[model samples]
Target: MAGDEDMKEGGLDWAAAYRRLDRLAAATDAAATTDPEQEREVMDERARRLARTVSARATPGHLLELVHFHAGEQDYALETRFVREVLRSSEQRVTLPGAPEQLRGVVLLHGEVLAVVELSPLFGRPAPTHHGPVLVVGQGRAELGLRADRVEEVLSVSRDALLPPPPALGAQERTLVAGLTREGIIVLEGEALLRDGRLFFDLSEERVS
Candidate 1:
Protein backbone atom coordinates (compact mmCIF):
# COMPACT_ATOMS: atom_id res chain seq x y z
CA MET A 1 0.00 0.00 0.00
CA ALA A 2 1.15 3.55 -0.69
CA GLY A 3 0.45 4.61 2.88
CA ASP A 4 2.45 1.66 4.20
CA GLU A 5 5.24 2.44 1.75
CA ASP A 6 5.16 6.05 2.85
CA MET A 7 5.33 5.00 6.47
CA LYS A 8 8.36 2.91 5.67
CA GLU A 9 10.09 5.72 3.73
CA GLY A 10 9.13 8.44 6.23
CA GLY A 11 6.61 9.86 3.66
CA LEU A 12 6.30 11.67 0.35
CA ASP A 13 8.28 14.86 -0.13
CA TRP A 14 5.32 17.10 0.70
CA ALA A 15 7.58 19.83 2.02
CA ALA A 16 9.59 19.93 -1.19
CA ALA A 17 6.44 19.91 -3.36
CA TYR A 18 4.96 22.74 -1.28
CA ARG A 19 8.14 24.78 -1.58
CA ARG A 20 8.25 24.27 -5.34
CA LEU A 21 4.62 25.36 -5.74
CA ASP A 22 5.20 28.38 -3.51
CA ARG A 23 8.18 29.44 -5.57
CA LEU A 24 6.15 29.03 -8.78
CA ALA A 25 3.37 31.19 -7.32
CA ALA A 26 5.85 33.84 -6.25
CA ALA A 27 7.44 33.88 -9.68
CA THR A 28 4.00 34.18 -11.31
CA ASP A 29 3.09 37.08 -9.02
CA ALA A 30 6.35 38.85 -9.84
CA ALA A 31 5.80 38.34 -13.58
CA ALA A 32 2.25 39.76 -13.38
CA THR A 33 3.31 43.24 -12.24
CA THR A 34 2.15 44.90 -15.47
CA ASP A 35 -1.33 45.96 -16.65
CA PRO A 36 -4.46 44.53 -14.99
CA GLU A 37 -5.51 42.46 -18.03
CA GLN A 38 -2.02 41.09 -18.52
CA GLU A 39 -1.74 40.27 -14.82
CA ARG A 40 -5.01 38.34 -14.87
CA GLU A 41 -3.97 36.33 -17.90
CA VAL A 42 -0.57 35.46 -16.49
CA MET A 43 -2.06 34.54 -13.11
CA ASP A 44 -4.67 32.25 -14.66
CA GLU A 45 -2.08 30.46 -16.77
CA ARG A 46 0.26 29.90 -13.85
CA ALA A 47 -2.60 28.84 -11.58
CA ARG A 48 -3.77 26.19 -14.08
CA ARG A 49 -0.22 24.88 -14.40
CA LEU A 50 0.14 24.72 -10.64
CA ALA A 51 -3.19 22.92 -10.30
CA ARG A 52 -2.17 20.32 -12.91
CA THR A 53 1.04 19.65 -11.03
CA VAL A 54 -0.81 19.18 -7.75
CA SER A 55 -3.51 16.91 -9.21
CA ALA A 56 -0.93 14.68 -10.91
CA ARG A 57 0.26 13.49 -7.49
CA ALA A 58 -2.52 11.07 -6.64
CA THR A 59 -3.58 10.17 -3.11
CA PRO A 60 -3.17 6.53 -2.07
CA GLY A 61 -5.88 4.39 -3.70
CA HIS A 62 -6.26 2.26 -0.58
CA LEU A 63 -6.93 5.27 1.62
CA LEU A 64 -10.38 6.79 1.72
CA GLU A 65 -10.03 10.51 2.39
CA LEU A 66 -13.20 12.06 3.71
CA VAL A 67 -14.39 15.52 4.69
CA HIS A 68 -16.96 15.27 7.44
CA PHE A 69 -19.72 17.83 7.88
CA HIS A 70 -23.14 18.34 9.46
CA ALA A 71 -26.32 19.39 7.67
CA GLY A 72 -29.49 18.18 9.37
CA GLU A 73 -28.22 17.65 12.89
CA GLN A 74 -26.46 14.57 11.50
CA ASP A 75 -22.92 13.98 10.42
CA TYR A 76 -22.03 13.11 6.83
CA ALA A 77 -18.73 12.31 5.20
CA LEU A 78 -17.86 13.02 1.55
CA GLU A 79 -14.91 11.58 -0.28
CA THR A 80 -12.21 14.24 -0.32
CA ARG A 81 -11.37 13.63 -3.99
CA PHE A 82 -14.79 15.00 -4.97
CA VAL A 83 -14.36 18.04 -2.71
CA ARG A 84 -12.54 20.91 -4.41
CA GLU A 85 -12.40 23.23 -1.41
CA VAL A 86 -14.32 24.38 1.63
CA LEU A 87 -15.25 28.05 2.04
CA ARG A 88 -17.24 30.08 4.56
CA SER A 89 -20.91 30.52 3.57
CA SER A 90 -21.23 33.99 5.05
CA GLU A 91 -20.96 35.48 1.57
CA GLN A 92 -24.25 36.63 0.10
CA ARG A 93 -25.96 33.79 -1.77
CA VAL A 94 -28.27 34.68 -4.60
CA THR A 95 -31.58 32.82 -4.51
CA LEU A 96 -33.34 31.89 -7.72
CA PRO A 97 -37.08 32.23 -7.45
CA GLY A 98 -39.27 29.25 -8.46
CA ALA A 99 -36.41 26.90 -7.81
CA PRO A 100 -36.87 23.64 -5.91
CA GLU A 101 -36.76 23.66 -2.10
CA GLN A 102 -33.56 21.67 -2.05
CA LEU A 103 -31.76 24.45 -3.86
CA ARG A 104 -30.71 27.05 -1.32
CA GLY A 105 -29.22 29.37 -3.94
CA VAL A 106 -26.16 29.99 -6.04
CA VAL A 107 -22.82 31.07 -4.69
CA LEU A 108 -19.93 32.53 -6.67
CA LEU A 109 -16.81 30.46 -6.09
CA HIS A 110 -13.53 31.18 -7.81
CA GLY A 111 -15.33 32.91 -10.73
CA GLU A 112 -17.75 29.98 -11.17
CA VAL A 113 -21.40 29.79 -10.17
CA LEU A 114 -22.10 26.89 -7.79
CA ALA A 115 -25.62 25.75 -6.94
CA VAL A 116 -25.95 25.55 -3.16
CA VAL A 117 -27.91 22.52 -2.00
CA GLU A 118 -29.78 22.38 1.32
CA LEU A 119 -29.62 18.68 2.07
CA SER A 120 -31.79 18.59 5.17
CA PRO A 121 -35.07 18.55 3.24
CA LEU A 122 -33.82 15.68 1.10
CA PHE A 123 -33.71 13.48 4.20
CA GLY A 124 -36.96 14.90 5.68
CA ARG A 125 -35.19 16.84 8.42
CA PRO A 126 -35.34 20.50 9.36
CA ALA A 127 -32.43 22.49 8.04
CA PRO A 128 -29.78 23.21 10.63
CA THR A 129 -29.72 26.89 11.66
CA HIS A 130 -25.99 27.14 12.24
CA HIS A 131 -24.33 28.55 9.12
CA GLY A 132 -21.08 26.86 8.26
CA PRO A 133 -18.73 26.40 5.36
CA VAL A 134 -19.71 25.33 1.82
CA LEU A 135 -18.05 22.33 0.25
CA VAL A 136 -17.27 23.06 -3.41
CA VAL A 137 -17.54 19.98 -5.62
CA GLY A 138 -17.09 19.78 -9.37
CA GLN A 139 -17.91 17.00 -11.82
CA GLY A 140 -17.80 17.83 -15.50
CA ARG A 141 -20.37 20.61 -16.12
CA ALA A 142 -21.99 20.37 -12.70
CA GLU A 143 -20.55 22.30 -9.77
CA LEU A 144 -22.29 22.05 -6.41
CA GLY A 145 -22.14 24.12 -3.25
CA LEU A 146 -22.98 21.93 -0.24
CA ARG A 147 -23.61 23.88 2.95
CA ALA A 148 -22.91 22.42 6.36
CA ASP A 149 -23.54 23.49 9.93
CA ARG A 150 -20.00 22.47 10.78
CA VAL A 151 -17.05 20.97 8.94
CA GLU A 152 -15.47 18.32 11.14
CA GLU A 153 -12.18 17.37 9.50
CA VAL A 154 -10.49 15.70 6.55
CA LEU A 155 -9.88 12.14 7.64
CA SER A 156 -7.77 9.45 6.01
CA VAL A 157 -9.14 6.04 6.79
CA SER A 158 -8.35 2.61 5.46
CA ARG A 159 -10.67 1.23 2.78
CA ASP A 160 -11.57 -1.54 5.20
CA ALA A 161 -13.21 1.03 7.44
CA LEU A 162 -16.13 1.41 5.05
CA LEU A 163 -19.13 -0.77 5.81
CA PRO A 164 -22.20 -1.38 3.66
CA PRO A 165 -25.16 0.91 4.28
CA PRO A 166 -27.85 -0.49 6.54
CA PRO A 167 -31.16 -1.63 5.02
CA ALA A 168 -32.94 0.88 7.25
CA LEU A 169 -31.76 3.64 4.92
CA GLY A 170 -34.38 4.28 2.21
CA ALA A 171 -33.67 3.45 -1.42
CA GLN A 172 -32.89 7.02 -2.53
CA GLU A 173 -30.75 7.78 0.50
CA ARG A 174 -29.00 4.46 0.21
CA THR A 175 -28.07 5.29 -3.36
CA LEU A 176 -26.47 8.50 -2.22
CA VAL A 177 -24.91 7.04 0.90
CA ALA A 178 -21.93 4.90 0.03
CA GLY A 179 -21.55 3.34 3.48
CA LEU A 180 -20.65 4.03 7.08
CA THR A 181 -17.17 4.71 8.36
CA ARG A 182 -15.72 2.73 11.22
CA GLU A 183 -16.64 5.56 13.61
CA GLY A 184 -20.17 5.51 12.16
CA ILE A 185 -20.00 8.67 10.08
CA ILE A 186 -22.43 8.33 7.15
CA VAL A 187 -20.18 8.29 4.15
CA LEU A 188 -21.91 9.90 1.15
CA GLU A 189 -21.29 9.16 -2.50
CA GLY A 190 -21.20 12.78 -3.53
CA GLU A 191 -20.43 12.03 -7.16
CA ALA A 192 -23.47 9.80 -7.42
CA LEU A 193 -25.68 12.50 -5.93
CA LEU A 194 -24.28 15.10 -8.29
CA ARG A 195 -24.86 12.84 -11.26
CA ASP A 196 -28.43 12.05 -10.27
CA GLY A 197 -30.36 14.11 -12.81
CA ARG A 198 -33.54 13.94 -10.76
CA LEU A 199 -31.86 15.28 -7.62
CA PHE A 200 -29.62 17.83 -9.31
CA PHE A 201 -30.95 21.32 -10.03
CA ASP A 202 -29.33 22.89 -13.05
CA LEU A 203 -28.52 26.52 -12.25
CA SER A 204 -27.28 27.29 -15.77
CA GLU A 205 -30.78 28.31 -16.92
CA GLU A 206 -31.37 30.48 -13.85
CA ARG A 207 -30.30 34.08 -13.57
CA VAL A 208 -27.77 34.96 -10.89
CA SER A 209 -27.43 38.55 -9.75
Candidate 2:
Protein backbone atom coordinates (compact mmCIF):
# COMPACT_ATOMS: atom_id res chain seq x y z
CA MET A 1 0.00 0.00 0.00
CA ALA A 2 2.87 2.41 0.85
CA GLY A 3 4.55 1.68 -2.49
CA ASP A 4 1.23 2.25 -4.37
CA GLU A 5 0.73 5.64 -2.64
CA ASP A 6 4.30 6.71 -3.52
CA MET A 7 3.72 5.69 -7.15
CA LYS A 8 0.48 7.70 -7.32
CA GLU A 9 2.27 10.82 -5.96
CA GLY A 10 5.08 10.38 -8.45
CA GLY A 11 2.51 10.06 -11.27
CA LEU A 12 0.89 13.36 -10.26
CA ASP A 13 4.27 15.10 -10.13
CA TRP A 14 5.13 13.82 -13.62
CA ALA A 15 1.79 14.98 -15.02
CA ALA A 16 2.33 18.44 -13.52
CA ALA A 17 5.88 18.61 -14.92
CA TYR A 18 4.62 17.59 -18.37
CA ARG A 19 1.98 20.35 -18.28
CA ARG A 20 4.67 22.94 -17.36
CA LEU A 21 6.91 21.74 -20.21
CA ASP A 22 4.06 22.00 -22.69
CA ARG A 23 3.27 25.59 -21.58
CA LEU A 24 6.94 26.57 -21.91
CA ALA A 25 7.05 25.10 -25.43
CA ALA A 26 3.94 26.98 -26.46
CA ALA A 27 5.41 30.23 -25.15
CA THR A 28 8.66 29.65 -27.04
CA ASP A 29 6.78 28.96 -30.28
CA ALA A 30 4.65 32.11 -29.89
CA ALA A 31 7.77 34.22 -29.31
CA ALA A 32 9.45 32.83 -32.41
CA THR A 33 6.33 33.34 -34.57
CA THR A 34 6.05 37.01 -33.50
CA ASP A 35 9.70 37.98 -33.94
CA PRO A 36 10.01 41.79 -33.70
CA GLU A 37 13.00 41.88 -36.07
CA GLN A 38 11.01 40.17 -38.85
CA GLU A 39 8.06 42.54 -38.34
CA ARG A 40 10.38 45.56 -38.52
CA GLU A 41 11.93 44.29 -41.76
CA VAL A 42 8.49 43.86 -43.39
CA MET A 43 7.39 47.33 -42.30
CA ASP A 44 10.62 48.88 -43.59
CA GLU A 45 10.26 47.24 -46.99
CA ARG A 46 6.61 48.41 -47.29
CA ALA A 47 7.54 51.99 -46.37
CA ARG A 48 10.42 52.05 -48.89
CA ARG A 49 8.15 50.80 -51.68
CA LEU A 50 5.50 53.40 -50.86
CA ALA A 51 8.05 56.21 -50.86
CA ARG A 52 9.35 55.13 -54.27
CA THR A 53 5.84 55.03 -55.75
CA VAL A 54 5.03 58.52 -54.46
CA SER A 55 8.31 59.92 -55.77
CA ALA A 56 7.70 58.44 -59.20
CA ARG A 57 4.18 59.88 -59.41
CA ALA A 58 5.20 63.42 -58.47
CA THR A 59 5.32 66.02 -61.32
CA PRO A 60 6.45 69.61 -61.66
CA GLY A 61 4.08 72.41 -62.70
CA HIS A 62 3.50 76.12 -62.24
CA LEU A 63 1.45 76.90 -59.11
CA LEU A 64 -0.95 79.84 -59.09
CA GLU A 65 -3.13 81.37 -56.35
CA LEU A 66 -6.57 82.85 -57.06
CA VAL A 67 -8.82 84.87 -54.76
CA HIS A 68 -12.48 83.73 -54.79
CA PHE A 69 -14.98 86.50 -54.05
CA HIS A 70 -18.60 86.05 -53.08
CA ALA A 71 -21.36 88.47 -51.98
CA GLY A 72 -19.73 91.34 -50.09
CA GLU A 73 -17.22 88.91 -48.62
CA GLN A 74 -14.03 87.42 -50.02
CA ASP A 75 -14.32 83.78 -48.97
CA TYR A 76 -11.89 81.43 -50.72
CA ALA A 77 -8.92 80.86 -53.00
CA LEU A 78 -8.38 78.76 -56.12
CA GLU A 79 -5.39 77.69 -58.14
CA THR A 80 -5.05 80.12 -61.07
CA ARG A 81 -3.88 77.30 -63.32
CA PHE A 82 -7.45 76.00 -63.11
CA VAL A 83 -8.94 79.33 -64.16
CA ARG A 84 -9.53 79.60 -67.94
CA GLU A 85 -10.12 83.33 -68.21
CA VAL A 86 -11.43 86.47 -66.50
CA LEU A 87 -14.06 88.75 -68.07
CA ARG A 88 -15.60 92.11 -67.20
CA SER A 89 -19.05 92.00 -65.57
CA SER A 90 -20.40 94.26 -68.31
CA GLU A 91 -19.28 91.80 -70.97
CA GLN A 92 -21.63 89.11 -69.55
CA ARG A 93 -25.35 89.41 -70.32
CA VAL A 94 -28.44 87.56 -69.03
CA THR A 95 -30.34 85.25 -71.38
CA LEU A 96 -33.78 83.54 -71.42
CA PRO A 97 -35.00 80.02 -70.36
CA GLY A 98 -32.84 76.86 -70.06
CA ALA A 99 -30.65 78.67 -67.52
CA PRO A 100 -30.73 78.10 -63.75
CA GLU A 101 -32.08 80.64 -61.26
CA GLN A 102 -28.61 81.07 -59.81
CA LEU A 103 -27.31 81.35 -63.37
CA ARG A 104 -27.51 85.02 -64.42
CA GLY A 105 -27.11 83.98 -68.04
CA VAL A 106 -24.77 82.26 -70.45
CA VAL A 107 -21.66 84.07 -71.52
CA LEU A 108 -19.65 83.45 -74.67
CA LEU A 109 -16.27 82.82 -73.13
CA HIS A 110 -13.52 81.55 -75.40
CA GLY A 111 -16.26 80.75 -77.92
CA GLU A 112 -18.04 78.51 -75.39
CA VAL A 113 -21.49 79.19 -73.92
CA LEU A 114 -20.61 79.35 -70.24
CA ALA A 115 -23.31 79.57 -67.56
CA VAL A 116 -22.74 82.50 -65.22
CA VAL A 117 -23.89 81.75 -61.64
CA GLU A 118 -24.48 84.33 -58.95
CA LEU A 119 -22.56 83.27 -55.84
CA SER A 120 -24.62 85.23 -53.27
CA PRO A 121 -27.99 83.50 -53.70
CA LEU A 122 -26.30 80.10 -53.76
CA PHE A 123 -24.94 80.87 -50.29
CA GLY A 124 -28.41 81.95 -49.01
CA ARG A 125 -27.60 85.68 -49.27
CA PRO A 126 -28.99 88.45 -51.45
CA ALA A 127 -27.17 89.01 -54.71
CA PRO A 128 -24.93 92.04 -54.43
CA THR A 129 -25.55 94.91 -56.88
CA HIS A 130 -21.84 95.46 -56.97
CA HIS A 131 -20.19 95.29 -60.39
CA GLY A 132 -17.17 93.06 -60.41
CA PRO A 133 -15.21 90.73 -62.65
CA VAL A 134 -16.44 87.32 -63.73
CA LEU A 135 -14.13 84.34 -63.40
CA VAL A 136 -14.71 81.73 -66.08
CA VAL A 137 -13.82 78.24 -64.83
CA GLY A 138 -13.35 75.51 -67.42
CA GLN A 139 -15.51 72.48 -66.81
CA GLY A 140 -15.45 69.11 -68.59
CA ARG A 141 -16.81 70.25 -71.95
CA ALA A 142 -18.00 73.74 -70.98
CA GLU A 143 -17.18 76.55 -68.60
CA LEU A 144 -19.07 78.36 -65.80
CA GLY A 145 -18.84 81.99 -64.72
CA LEU A 146 -18.64 83.03 -61.08
CA ARG A 147 -19.53 86.72 -60.68
CA ALA A 148 -17.60 88.24 -57.83
CA ASP A 149 -17.89 91.64 -56.22
CA ARG A 150 -14.28 92.21 -57.15
CA VAL A 151 -11.24 90.41 -58.44
CA GLU A 152 -8.43 90.67 -55.97
CA GLU A 153 -4.82 90.46 -56.98
CA VAL A 154 -3.45 87.04 -57.84
CA LEU A 155 -1.18 85.85 -55.05
CA SER A 156 1.63 83.31 -55.13
CA VAL A 157 0.96 81.05 -52.17
CA SER A 158 2.90 77.92 -51.35
CA ARG A 159 1.22 74.54 -51.27
CA ASP A 160 1.96 74.30 -47.57
CA ALA A 161 -0.15 77.38 -46.87
CA LEU A 162 -3.32 75.61 -48.06
CA LEU A 163 -5.16 73.93 -45.15
CA PRO A 164 -8.37 71.98 -44.68
CA PRO A 165 -11.74 73.73 -44.54
CA PRO A 166 -13.42 74.59 -41.23
CA PRO A 167 -15.94 72.20 -39.69
CA ALA A 168 -18.41 75.03 -39.08
CA LEU A 169 -19.13 75.60 -42.79
CA GLY A 170 -22.66 74.58 -43.79
CA ALA A 171 -23.50 71.74 -46.19
CA GLN A 172 -23.61 73.93 -49.30
CA GLU A 173 -20.42 75.69 -48.39
CA ARG A 174 -18.79 72.43 -47.44
CA THR A 175 -19.65 70.95 -50.82
CA LEU A 176 -18.30 74.00 -52.62
CA VAL A 177 -15.34 74.72 -50.36
CA ALA A 178 -12.10 72.81 -50.29
CA GLY A 179 -9.50 73.31 -47.56
CA LEU A 180 -8.75 76.57 -45.73
CA THR A 181 -5.63 78.70 -45.50
CA ARG A 182 -4.39 81.79 -43.66
CA GLU A 183 -6.31 83.75 -46.31
CA GLY A 184 -9.44 81.53 -46.03
CA ILE A 185 -10.84 78.26 -47.34
CA ILE A 186 -10.10 77.30 -50.95
CA VAL A 187 -12.85 76.47 -53.42
CA LEU A 188 -12.42 73.11 -55.21
CA GLU A 189 -15.91 72.77 -56.68
CA GLY A 190 -15.60 74.81 -59.84
CA GLU A 191 -16.62 71.68 -61.68
CA ALA A 192 -19.48 71.08 -59.28
CA LEU A 193 -20.69 74.67 -59.68
CA LEU A 194 -20.93 74.20 -63.42
CA ARG A 195 -22.41 70.69 -63.35
CA ASP A 196 -25.12 71.64 -60.88
CA GLY A 197 -27.72 73.00 -63.33
CA ARG A 198 -30.14 73.77 -60.49
CA LEU A 199 -28.20 76.94 -59.69
CA PHE A 200 -29.86 79.74 -61.74
CA PHE A 201 -30.16 83.48 -61.48
CA ASP A 202 -32.61 84.71 -58.85
CA LEU A 203 -34.25 87.21 -61.25
CA SER A 204 -37.19 86.17 -63.38
CA GLU A 205 -37.43 86.94 -67.10
CA GLU A 206 -40.47 89.10 -66.45
CA ARG A 207 -38.68 91.05 -63.69
CA VAL A 208 -35.65 91.67 -65.87
CA SER A 209 -37.92 92.39 -68.83
Candidate 3:
Protein backbone atom coordinates (compact mmCIF):
# COMPACT_ATOMS: atom_id res chain seq x y z
CA MET A 1 0.00 0.00 0.00
CA ALA A 2 3.04 2.25 -0.21
CA GLY A 3 2.11 3.71 -3.54
CA ASP A 4 -1.58 2.77 -3.20
CA GLU A 5 -2.47 6.28 -2.09
CA ASP A 6 -2.51 7.14 -5.81
CA MET A 7 -5.07 4.40 -6.44
CA LYS A 8 -7.82 5.98 -8.50
CA GLU A 9 -11.31 4.54 -8.89
CA GLY A 10 -11.13 1.99 -11.71
CA GLY A 11 -13.92 1.36 -14.22
CA LEU A 12 -12.74 2.44 -17.66
CA ASP A 13 -9.60 0.37 -18.32
CA TRP A 14 -10.58 -2.88 -16.60
CA ALA A 15 -14.22 -2.67 -17.69
CA ALA A 16 -13.20 -2.10 -21.31
CA ALA A 17 -11.09 -5.28 -21.25
CA TYR A 18 -14.03 -7.24 -19.88
CA ARG A 19 -16.31 -5.76 -22.58
CA ARG A 20 -13.89 -6.91 -25.28
CA LEU A 21 -13.85 -10.38 -23.73
CA ASP A 22 -17.66 -10.47 -23.61
CA ARG A 23 -17.93 -9.57 -27.31
CA LEU A 24 -15.35 -12.20 -28.29
CA ALA A 25 -17.01 -14.81 -26.08
CA ALA A 26 -20.43 -14.12 -27.58
CA ALA A 27 -18.97 -14.36 -31.07
CA THR A 28 -17.59 -17.86 -30.42
CA ASP A 29 -20.79 -19.19 -28.87
CA ALA A 30 -22.96 -17.59 -31.56
CA ALA A 31 -20.82 -18.64 -34.54
CA ALA A 32 -23.25 -19.80 -37.24
CA THR A 33 -22.34 -21.44 -40.51
CA THR A 34 -24.06 -23.89 -42.83
CA ASP A 35 -20.76 -25.78 -43.18
CA PRO A 36 -19.23 -27.37 -40.09
CA GLU A 37 -15.68 -26.93 -41.39
CA GLN A 38 -16.14 -23.19 -41.92
CA GLU A 39 -17.49 -22.78 -38.42
CA ARG A 40 -14.52 -24.65 -36.96
CA GLU A 41 -12.10 -22.45 -38.87
CA VAL A 42 -13.83 -19.27 -37.69
CA MET A 43 -13.84 -20.41 -34.09
CA ASP A 44 -10.16 -21.34 -34.20
CA GLU A 45 -9.19 -17.91 -35.49
CA ARG A 46 -11.20 -16.13 -32.82
CA ALA A 47 -9.65 -18.33 -30.13
CA ARG A 48 -6.17 -17.46 -31.30
CA ARG A 49 -7.06 -13.76 -31.30
CA LEU A 50 -8.41 -14.05 -27.79
CA ALA A 51 -5.21 -15.74 -26.63
CA ARG A 52 -3.20 -12.86 -28.02
CA THR A 53 -5.45 -10.32 -26.34
CA VAL A 54 -5.14 -12.16 -23.05
CA SER A 55 -1.35 -12.28 -23.20
CA ALA A 56 -1.23 -8.57 -24.01
CA ARG A 57 -3.10 -7.81 -20.77
CA ALA A 58 -0.12 -8.77 -18.61
CA THR A 59 0.81 -5.91 -16.24
CA PRO A 60 1.65 -3.00 -18.47
CA GLY A 61 4.05 -0.50 -16.95
CA HIS A 62 4.18 -2.57 -13.73
CA LEU A 63 0.64 -1.35 -13.12
CA LEU A 64 -1.37 -4.27 -11.82
CA GLU A 65 -5.12 -4.43 -12.26
CA LEU A 66 -6.61 -6.59 -9.52
CA VAL A 67 -10.01 -8.04 -8.70
CA HIS A 68 -10.56 -7.30 -5.01
CA PHE A 69 -12.86 -9.48 -2.96
CA HIS A 70 -13.59 -10.86 0.50
CA ALA A 71 -13.32 -14.42 1.72
CA GLY A 72 -14.85 -14.65 5.16
CA GLU A 73 -13.44 -11.68 7.06
CA GLN A 74 -10.15 -11.31 5.17
CA ASP A 75 -9.55 -9.11 2.13
CA TYR A 76 -7.73 -10.51 -0.93
CA ALA A 77 -7.03 -9.76 -4.55
CA LEU A 78 -5.72 -11.53 -7.63
CA GLU A 79 -4.33 -10.08 -10.82
CA THR A 80 -7.14 -9.46 -13.30
CA ARG A 81 -5.16 -11.19 -16.05
CA PHE A 82 -5.95 -14.58 -14.47
CA VAL A 83 -9.63 -13.95 -13.70
CA ARG A 84 -11.94 -15.28 -16.43
CA GLU A 85 -15.28 -14.37 -14.88
CA VAL A 86 -17.24 -14.16 -11.63
CA LEU A 87 -20.29 -16.35 -11.14
CA ARG A 88 -22.86 -15.18 -8.60
CA SER A 89 -23.73 -18.73 -7.69
CA SER A 90 -22.02 -22.11 -7.81
CA GLU A 91 -25.11 -24.01 -8.84
CA GLN A 92 -25.04 -27.80 -8.44
CA ARG A 93 -21.74 -27.91 -6.60
CA VAL A 94 -20.99 -31.60 -6.16
CA THR A 95 -19.00 -32.43 -3.06
CA LEU A 96 -16.20 -34.90 -3.59
CA PRO A 97 -15.38 -37.80 -1.29
CA GLY A 98 -11.90 -38.33 0.21
CA ALA A 99 -10.66 -35.08 -1.26
CA PRO A 100 -8.40 -32.65 0.62
CA GLU A 101 -10.18 -30.17 2.88
CA GLN A 102 -9.17 -27.35 0.57
CA LEU A 103 -10.86 -29.04 -2.39
CA ARG A 104 -14.38 -27.82 -1.70
CA GLY A 105 -16.17 -29.55 -4.59
CA VAL A 106 -16.78 -29.44 -8.33
CA VAL A 107 -19.30 -27.68 -10.50
CA LEU A 108 -20.14 -28.05 -14.18
CA LEU A 109 -19.10 -24.88 -15.96
CA HIS A 110 -19.11 -24.25 -19.69
CA GLY A 111 -19.46 -28.01 -20.24
CA GLU A 112 -16.41 -28.83 -18.10
CA VAL A 113 -16.04 -29.82 -14.46
CA LEU A 114 -14.47 -26.90 -12.60
CA ALA A 115 -13.07 -27.50 -9.14
CA VAL A 116 -14.34 -25.06 -6.51
CA VAL A 117 -11.52 -24.28 -4.08
CA GLU A 118 -12.23 -23.53 -0.45
CA LEU A 119 -9.93 -20.64 0.51
CA SER A 120 -10.25 -20.90 4.29
CA PRO A 121 -7.93 -23.86 4.88
CA LEU A 122 -5.39 -22.34 2.58
CA PHE A 123 -5.31 -19.08 4.51
CA GLY A 124 -5.52 -20.85 7.88
CA ARG A 125 -8.88 -19.21 8.47
CA PRO A 126 -12.07 -20.98 9.50
CA ALA A 127 -14.60 -21.90 6.82
CA PRO A 128 -17.38 -19.48 6.01
CA THR A 129 -21.05 -20.19 6.75
CA HIS A 130 -21.59 -20.97 3.05
CA HIS A 131 -20.17 -20.37 -0.37
CA GLY A 132 -20.82 -17.10 -2.15
CA PRO A 133 -19.48 -15.80 -5.51
CA VAL A 134 -17.14 -17.99 -7.52
CA LEU A 135 -14.21 -16.30 -9.20
CA VAL A 136 -13.44 -18.42 -12.28
CA VAL A 137 -9.72 -18.36 -12.88
CA GLY A 138 -6.82 -20.02 -14.79
CA GLN A 139 -6.69 -22.30 -17.86
CA GLY A 140 -7.81 -25.84 -18.74
CA ARG A 141 -7.31 -28.49 -16.01
CA ALA A 142 -5.52 -25.97 -13.81
CA GLU A 143 -8.56 -23.68 -13.71
CA LEU A 144 -10.61 -23.33 -10.51
CA GLY A 145 -13.57 -21.46 -9.08
CA LEU A 146 -12.53 -19.63 -5.92
CA ARG A 147 -15.43 -19.38 -3.46
CA ALA A 148 -15.75 -15.87 -2.11
CA ASP A 149 -18.05 -13.97 0.27
CA ARG A 150 -18.33 -10.80 -1.85
CA VAL A 151 -16.53 -9.07 -4.66
CA GLU A 152 -15.56 -5.47 -4.11
CA GLU A 153 -14.19 -3.83 -7.29
CA VAL A 154 -11.27 -3.87 -9.65
CA LEU A 155 -8.47 -1.46 -8.87
CA SER A 156 -5.19 -0.51 -10.57
CA VAL A 157 -2.12 -0.20 -8.38
CA SER A 158 1.58 -0.15 -9.06
CA ARG A 159 3.58 -3.27 -8.20
CA ASP A 160 5.86 -1.10 -6.09
CA ALA A 161 3.03 -0.51 -3.68
CA LEU A 162 3.13 -4.12 -2.46
CA LEU A 163 5.15 -4.96 0.65
CA PRO A 164 6.54 -8.33 1.60
CA PRO A 165 4.23 -10.40 3.73
CA PRO A 166 4.73 -10.53 7.50
CA PRO A 167 7.49 -12.93 8.57
CA ALA A 168 5.31 -14.86 10.99
CA LEU A 169 3.13 -16.48 8.27
CA GLY A 170 3.83 -20.14 7.57
CA ALA A 171 5.78 -21.11 4.43
CA GLN A 172 2.72 -22.57 2.70
CA GLU A 173 0.71 -19.40 3.27
CA ARG A 174 3.62 -17.18 2.33
CA THR A 175 4.18 -19.00 -0.96
CA LEU A 176 0.86 -17.80 -2.40
CA VAL A 177 1.29 -14.17 -1.43
CA ALA A 178 2.73 -11.83 -4.01
CA GLY A 179 2.68 -8.96 -1.57
CA LEU A 180 0.58 -7.23 1.04
CA THR A 181 -0.88 -3.77 1.04
CA ARG A 182 -0.18 -1.57 4.04
CA GLU A 183 -3.90 -1.72 4.75
CA GLY A 184 -3.40 -5.56 4.99
CA ILE A 185 -5.05 -6.78 1.82
CA ILE A 186 -3.25 -9.89 0.59
CA VAL A 187 -2.50 -9.58 -3.11
CA LEU A 188 -1.80 -13.05 -4.46
CA GLU A 189 0.23 -14.28 -7.37
CA GLY A 190 -2.30 -15.84 -9.71
CA GLU A 191 -0.11 -18.53 -11.28
CA ALA A 192 1.27 -19.67 -7.93
CA LEU A 193 -2.22 -20.13 -6.59
CA LEU A 194 -3.29 -22.16 -9.62
CA ARG A 195 -0.16 -24.28 -9.70
CA ASP A 196 -0.56 -25.38 -6.08
CA GLY A 197 -0.67 -29.19 -6.09
CA ARG A 198 -3.16 -29.14 -3.24
CA LEU A 199 -5.95 -27.50 -5.25
CA PHE A 200 -5.90 -30.00 -8.14
CA PHE A 201 -6.87 -33.50 -7.03
CA ASP A 202 -6.81 -36.68 -9.10
CA LEU A 203 -9.88 -38.38 -7.72
CA SER A 204 -9.53 -41.86 -9.17
CA GLU A 205 -12.03 -44.47 -8.00
CA GLU A 206 -9.55 -45.88 -5.51
CA ARG A 207 -8.44 -42.44 -4.43
CA VAL A 208 -11.99 -41.46 -3.66
CA SER A 209 -12.35 -44.34 -1.23
Give the residue spans of candidate 3 off by over 4 A. 1-56, 97-99, 139-142, 203-209
State the TM-score for model 3: 0.68
Off by over 4 Å in 2: 1-64, 67-71, 89-92, 95-101, 110-112, 140-142, 200-209
- Judge candidate 2 at residue 136 and give its lDDT: 62
- In angstroms, give how far residue 112 of model 3 lies from its true place: 0.7
Q: Can you write out model 1's per-residue Cα lDDT over 67-152, one digit (the tens) per residue?
A: 78887777888776677666664444554434466766555544455667877776668755445677777643337888888888
Error of 1 at 54 (Å): 4.3
Model 1 worst lDDT run, 10 consecutive residues: 1-10
Instruction: Give me the overall lDDT of model 1.
Output: 0.64
lDDT of 3 at 106: 62
lDDT pick, better of 1 and 2: 1
Shift of residue 185 alpha carbon in model 1, Å = 0.7
Write the residue-wise lDDT of candidate 2 on 1-209 in tens digits. Answer: 01121123212222332233345456545764789887577567657744643343312233435545544465655555445555654433433333344655445443334556777665656666545677766533335677776666555655556676677667867777655667564555554655555663333223221
**Per-residue C-alpha lDDT of model 3 across residues 7-103, encoded as one tens digit per residue:** 2243112223223334444554565534678788856875774574366356535888888999979999888778777777654455443346776
TM-score of each: 0.65, 0.53, 0.68
Choose 1 or 2, whichever is better by TM-score.
Answer: 1
Instruction: Say which prediction, candidate 2 or candidate 3, comes out ahead on lDDT.
Output: 3
TM-score of 1: 0.65
Clashes of each: 0, 8, 0
